[model samples]
Target: MKLYTEEWMKILEHIENNDRDYKLFSINYDSNYWFHAKVKGDEVEISNAKFHENSCSIPNPRKISIKEFSLAFPLYKQYTSGVPGIRYKMQKRKIYNSSYIIALIHEIIDDYYFRFSNILNK
Candidate 1:
C-alpha cells in the first residue's frame, strides 16, 4: 500500500473542503492508540494519544503524516482479528470495553473512508 501518493492528495483535498471529525483506533499486541482529526473549513487539527485503562495521555496536536496513516490499517486489522465475537454484539455497555472501542473505530473508519475509494482499497 502506497501512501503520500496522488491518492493521498485527494484525501487531503476532501478534508480541506469539508467539515468532519474522524478518529482511527489501532492496537499493537497489548497497547491501544487513538488518532483523531478535526477539520473545519480550511483548518485541520490532528492529534494522537496512547490509550490506557486509567487515562489517555494526549500529546500536542500536529499534522498527521502518511507513515502514521499507513501503519494504522494493519494495526486495525490485527485488532479486529484478535477480538472474537465483536461483530455479534448488540447492546451497548456504558463501561470501558475493548469490544465497544473496536466497534466504534470500525464505524468511524468505514464512514470517513467511504469518500476515498483508494484508501480503503489499499
Candidate 2:
C-alpha cells in the first residue's frame, strides 16, 4: 500500500475540476515562490503551472525524472496566520480538504527533505 492514508487519497481524488487527468499538488517554498507537483506513477512530476479558479494546466513539465536535485528550504521563512484563514475558506467552498491534505503534504515534504539532505551530505 502507498504511504498515504485513505483520507488523504480521498482528498486527492476529490479534485473534480482539476481539468487534467492527474492529481496536482502545490509546493510553496515561501510566499514569493511555488511550484506544482503531480503524481506520475512511481515518481512525481514537477512543473510550472498556470492555476485557474478550479483547475490548472501545465504546458511543459519535467519529462525526465532527475537523478539528483536539491533545494534548501529558506531557513528564515515564517508562516503567516492569514494562510490558515484562506485555506479554511477554500475548504468551506469545497475546493479541497486542506486540513488533511496539508498534513499529508507535510509528511511527504519532510520525507523528501531528509532523503535529499542525506544524499547531498548537507
Candidate 3:
C-alpha cells in the first residue's frame, strides 16, 4: 500500500504539472492501487504490478477506450502530508488490535476510491 501511494504521488505530480501529454490512469484500493501513463504512443506502468486488463503493452500504448480508462478514489482522507489517515495511525500504534485496524483499513480503502474518482473526473 505504501508503494502504491508513492507511485500515485509520482503519477499525480506528472499530471498536475502537465509534464506529459500522456493520459494518466490510477485505480486506487482495488486490491491494487496502481498507476500507469501513455505518452506519445508509449505505455508505462509506474507501479511494479502486472496488467489486469487486455491493454498491457509498451511503445505502442495499448488502446484503452474511454470506458476502460477508469479510476477509483478514496472515500476518506488520503495519505496526504497534512494528515495521515486511520491506516497510518494503526500502523504506528504499538498495541493496535487486528479487528480495529482492519475496520480502519476498510474505511480508508473506500475513501481512496472516492478521492481518485473525484480527481480524475475533474
Number of the top-ranking candidate, with lDDT as the measure:
1
**Backbone clash numbers for all candidates listed:** 0, 0, 15
Prediction 1 global C-alpha lDDT:
0.42
Candidate 2 global CA lDDT score: 0.35
The true-versus-predicted C-alpha distance at residue 5 of model 1, in Å, is 3.1
Query: Model 3: how far is 53 from its true place, Å?
Result: 23
TM-score of model 3 relative to the true fold? 0.19
Per-residue lDDT of candidate 1, residues 1-122 (tens digit): 54434433444566565554344444435434444445434333554432323323445665444444443433344455556533333122222233323433364444555446547678
**lDDT by residue (tens digit), candidate 2, 13-50:** 43322433323334343322234555555334545533
Error of 3 at 23 (Å): 14
Q: Model 2: residues >4 Å from true position, as ranges?
A: 14-30, 52-122
As a whole number from 0 to 100, the lDDT of residue 8 in candidate 3 is 39
- Among the numbered candidates, top TM-score falls to 1
> Model 2 — TM-score against the truth?
0.26
* Residue 108 accuracy (lDDT) in model 3: 29
The candidates, ranked best first by lDDT, are 1, 2, 3
